[model samples]
Target: MEIFKSDKIFDFMGKRLPFLALSALLFLGSLGIIFTKGLNFGIDFAGGTLVQVKYEQNAPIDDIRQILQAHPKFANASITEFGTPQEIVIRISGSSTELGNDIGDTVHTLLDPTGAFEVRRVDMVGPKVGDELREKGIMAMSLSLLVILAYVSFRFEWRFAVASILALIHDVTIAIGALALFQVDVNLDILAAILTIMGYSLNDTIIVFDRIREGINTSKESKLLLVINESVSRTLSRTTLTSLTTFFVVVTLFVFGGEIIHGFAFTMVVGIIVGTYSSIFVASSFLAQLKFSVNNYRAREAEKLKKQKEKEKMRAMYEKGTV
Candidate 1:
């Protein structure tokens, strides 16, 4: 369905300079935020031990944090109420076997010498394993980009492949910057969200690229800028509808998904917004900047003309021979 009924022509590519500048500013700002503030890696990457405690009364989250702060081992522990105010979840720093498998006893003894509170459960991850997971996550992101690069290059043109990649990276960098800026826990779920965002952004970009390719193939417009602008304008409705619907769902998830998938939902929310923006502004504008050549189209037309001439020549020969 089309949102816009008018055959209005938008000079989207004409005002690309300001948009490109804005994109650059945002991209560099995101990089700076990432390097300076850094990601708040969770147990999946940073490695840590978690303990769930059930206090006899209110969890006393502030008191527990104050106590843990004074202790050398848990000086930087994470303390929060899980379910009811009486149910507390404490995360101990360090991924050693002792912290992982035995921190429960230490926490129980230190928090409640009288043994009033109960140590509900304890979970752990080794430092080595955490390092491996981090490496693999990086690999997964890199591999996905490489695959997209190769696929787009083979499917369309190198310019489009590069443009789409730029848009994808732009979307990811901004999304990750949001995570670091807000100090969101970068866990396995967040990584999954990043990958999902990459795919989502790529799909949107491909739609624009596909329209541009169609415009070029059909010689719908003489100027590359017109082709790009028309193509983007044509697909604008589809992009808006898809983005709005997906955004509504992710916003709902962010509100109600709970802490278990909170970061994931937040990532998706950022992805949808930034992904749509890059698809229209970044990907297509970059093509406009490159002055995408029509030499390939000229060559194809030449080939078609050559075949037509050959067919005509053969027909003339047959008519002369009266065969």
Candidate 2:
């Protein structure tokens, strides 16, 4: 069944040099930000006290912040509004043995003076747990990329694999960099977003690669550039439509998903846009440069080796027979 059709727009096949420069600039800038100011890990990554309090009525987040800050133990605490206005998520930095109880007691006094607010949950994570989580997050991301590379290489070619992986890296780095710049909390939720982005980005790259493969197989007399341009043009409608539909859903969540999923949805939106652009400008373009045919080259090499081996065997048989 036909899902969509391509509407030819100004060919985006030209001006490859400028696009490369812009992408490089973004990549290097993100790297620089990462080195200069590392990720702003939230409680999930840094191991801290998480306190969620539910009030009878909506509580003022700024007032809660002030209440936490009044105590020296909870100074510099992070506070976020969650769910209805009545709920607040408080993240207090790691406390020493002497001050942990005092910090909790102070928050209790401010919010539940007469049992107005109840402590929904109170959890303390050790620094070791945070370190382990950080390690695991990196491992998951690395393993995911390796798996994609191997699968793409096996299914298509190394050139396609490299381009797809690079695009994934680009999307992830930019997401992390934006987080650092804004001091966004790098937590398990954010990690989930990163992985989600990887999957979506890889899907987009695979679709484009599929089209490129089809073009090469079907068009016998088409030039490399023409084939690439056509492949991109043909798939452009489907890519844009799918991305747009997905983007609208993400935008809805971004607007209404509340504080809990805001960052996650935002990251997903960014990934969709970046993934689409890379599929066309990055993956297909790289494929053209490769100009390598896996099937043809392997078949030719195997044929040449087989012919040499047959000749060697025939000569050996003739010498033995004469002797």
**Predicted structure with the largest TM-score when compared to the true one:** 1
Query: Which digits, one per residue and each the tens of the lDDT, describe model 2 over residues 193-280?
Result: 8999899889988988787777776755346666677778888777888888999999999899987788888778877877778777
Model 1 quality (TM-score) = 0.86
* Candidate 1 wrongly placed segments (more than 4 Å): 53-58, 69-73, 81-88, 100-102, 105-121, 301-323
Give lDDT tens digits, candidate 1, residues 1-323: 88964366688989899999999998999999999999999887888887889878787777778777888888879898774677888876665575535688788777874336899887687888889999999999999999999999999878888888888889999999999999988989999999999999999999989888887777557788888888888888999999999999999999887666788999999989999999988888887777777666567767988999999999999999965
Against the reference, the lDDT scores of all candidates come to 0.86, 0.77
Cα miss at 222, model 2 (Å)?
4.3
Q: What TM-score would each prediction reach against the true structure?
A: 0.86, 0.80
Query: Which residue pairs in candidate 2 collide?
Result: none
